[model samples]
Target: MRASLPIERSLTAEQTTALGEFRARWAAVRRSTTPADRSAAEQAVRLAYHAAGLERPARIVWCDSPLALAGRVCRASHDDGGNVRSRLVDHVRRRVASLIERRVLRKVLVAVENSVNPADPLVTAVAEAVIRSVPEPSLSMLGHLRCTGLSWSGVLHAIIAPRGFASCAAGPHDLSWLGVYDYLREVLRLHAETEPLCGLMQLASSVGWLQPHARTCWLAERPNLLCGDARDRLHQADGPALRYPDGWSVWAWRGVEVPRWIIERRDQITLAAIDEQMDVQVRRCMIEIMTPECYVALGGATRIAEDETGILWRRNWLAADAWAAVEVINATPEPDGTRRHFFLQVPANLRTAREAVAWTYGMRAEAYAQLVQRT
Candidate 1:
């Protein structure tokens, strides 16, 4: 059946469907906002440990949220009381590493790429979903109180994951990769060793982040709140877009992760605060949250120039400096041919829209005006 998948130029025909029948299950797992079912998830973890040839943990720690569990484990991992934790981890599932991961992934890709009806809508839809769902979770958002910020699914799914929880000062990595591989395994039945794959599928359907020790394991509950924008980014306007029962939450605007104050203390978002932000994406989101007109009015900005090039506005940002910016329409049209407007901060001293826009590129206005069209 493995060679039959590609030699026949399809992993499964519509009659032998793989993607359609399996997409819903993986999608549900990825988007699930329900609390973890403790009994089921614990059993799944034990199943994984057994598959890895480790004994079932004698203790189970139930966490209110993945974020909460991650924070706890991370702090404890840092303060290892004289190497006690390290000794336990040495015998845990880290030894169950992947050896046939690449080969398995290659087989799946070849079957899909060489499928008989590669252009079929169902095929295209499933391919897009599978490719886009390869999660790349950011691990650096741990330090700041104010903080913020794959297509190769199977290569990562073959073994017990979070391979080195003992060393991870970093937070949780989601089970999305495991979800993808599980979908493929169940739908297409790609011939790899069965036990590890079955264990992974159970984990994919059951839990969020996990940490295993010799006699004990920690597992986080699923997020109680998960939201996304039309673009499929984590997003919500009124509150934390992603939140767990323990109150660990993330705030975002459109897709940009923002400080919680932008949503909670919105009336206090000042021009100075926005200007002080070094990340332009966060700054833009702050302005949008406050509304551009209100942000400009609050800063006492005055429109200085306007023309085909752009509209320029300037205002005092500090006692010693003026804030200047240009609102330019994108030269490229949208799919429906409407242009989107962009507001770019520029040098305060620039006298005109053309000059301000030109300065953004390290060029003189005279030089910019001669270009055929601007991107």
Candidate 2:
């Protein structure tokens, strides 16, 4: 007979109702006589328990039928019907107890991770107790450890960086542990008071000596501040630093060499230019563009094919060269005398395709418009 396990935590009224439903279903399944029907019913019972947030025991003893087994055993041993039912109930209790044990261990692991001081006597005692309770640690246990930040609890850990762990080992220069706490508090206060996307690049760039690591750390901690599309732009390598619509710009990495053009045009690349280029492309192609806010709503200067009738400008081509390979396509004229238009074709793999198109179009339009206005 399997030992009965106990529930570790109290269930709410809703969960209690769910558990009762699961028990009734399980009993019905166990009473089914047809082999296929019994098997399917047993599966339904397991699913119900899972829906109630209880994991069934991995191994369960299969019997022809609980009543049949009990009758045979009672007949052979001369036992009463009451004793047989008690033993059957014990099986169900044991399954519940196993689930509770798993839940308690998970709670203990979470408590350990959230503890401010892992060395606290109570924390250490509880952690050790949980660790020792499992006879042979399963992969699920290891997965839990990884998730709860306890995977390295008993292992030697190291953080290897090119500059060594000086900042963490002895703390950063002029900044003690308490001082770092105060600095973070100030940062958080400023972040809350000001617009989320404003001044991130400037603040990170101004943090002398810490510029390289500051941006990475800040983004990691407050990821919710930037939209997903805007955040992804920073990961590209070839383009000039991108400026987000929210007024945040990419922070320049320290100790890495950058092209002169990127440095010169860093402040010139704007989201407005990108949007304008996308607008032009949509108009030229006569194709509806899906604007998911991920790719700069597609606008920008593109290279016109030699046969196209559109105005060709040297300045537009030069600007386009800075971002992606552009080629124009000309199509048959429309009945209204307006020619069917095609936008510039840019290689998809170019990291700066979106930005380049935007910058080029913006520059060309601005230059030509200025000339016309002056004339």
Candidate 3:
């Protein structure tokens, strides 16, 4: 449980210059004459930092108000009428101005979750308003789109287990991914200790959030001196650390490859019956497990290993299943000299492993020989 991740080296000249430019632009935006100019400048900051080679680092910073325009424009419907749209634009302008002043580094990705029922009129209206004010190809839209073809287990499990998402935006925040893990683990343990007398909760959700509209967000700032091999090690050492209550879950998918195992397992874990749909895609997989201990742990489908062809089995409070494929995207050296392996475990009876793996990956038994190979 204890480990020391090496501190990354300093920034490159190009990155140094990029950061300098970002600062200058931000300063100007802070002094801008109008909201429109300010919002435009904010967008520029995001584009510039992302364009640079910054990877996931520790802590992400940004001003919520300034990025409002980009948020609003992207969510507006064409038929929502010009007045509503116009208001969204103005909101964006004001928000952008404030954001520049806040000095939020562009190296962070922001997610807003609607704590209210998705159907709540106010929630919908706010979401719409935020969306309407955003710039083209809204950040949220891009992030969600990247999640397409991924089952809920794929998304949520990845959030819980360690792995890199293919389309993670930005870098790390104040709490390194590993730090966040410890934080969550402690929070979960404490929650199980106290709370209502309804028995100890065993999963992630057992840790309650103070905010009603709870969501998680991710940011990956490329640390200096961590690239190529070292970067790969860093990722394996600190993959997909979660920051809960960010209003949405965010994964920093950098230098991480897809393992066929995870994809295959997903096929078995899905809600669809074996013959319910063909040439179909599975959206979410839910499993419930009843343990003899009277402690139930929910398992969500997950993408586990980068080298293998199976889904990582991930368990959280929502799942009731005992065993599942949790994907291991990265590996870190342990205190006893053993590698601290991170895997996405998916729910499966021992008998179902092969079928689940095959179904998800679409590979023949002979082809799966490697997966069966004990490392």
Best of the candidates, lDDT: 1
Q: Would you give me the overall lDDT of model 1?
A: 0.57
List RMSD in Å for every model shown.
Answer: 11.2, 27.8, 22.7
Quote the positional error of residue 357 for candidate 3 in Å: 5.9
Q: Which stretches of candidate 2 lie over 4 Å from their true place?
A: 1-232, 235-326, 330-336, 340-375
For candidate 1, the per-residue lDDT at 94 reads 33
lDDT of 2 by residue, 87-163 (tens): 22223334443443453455532332233112222212222222232232111232222322333541212111111
Candidate 3 contains a number of clashing pairs equal to: 94
Rank by TM-score, descending? Answer: 1, 3, 2
Which 10 consecutive residues of model 2 have the lowest summed lDDT?
214-223
| Clash pairs detected, candidate 2 | 4-94, 5-97, 6-97, 277-299, 277-300, 278-298, 278-299, 278-300, 305-328
- Of the candidates shown, which would achieve the greatest TM-score relative to the real structure? 1
lDDT of 1 at 37: 69
Compute the lDDT of residue 198 as modeled in candidate 3.
15
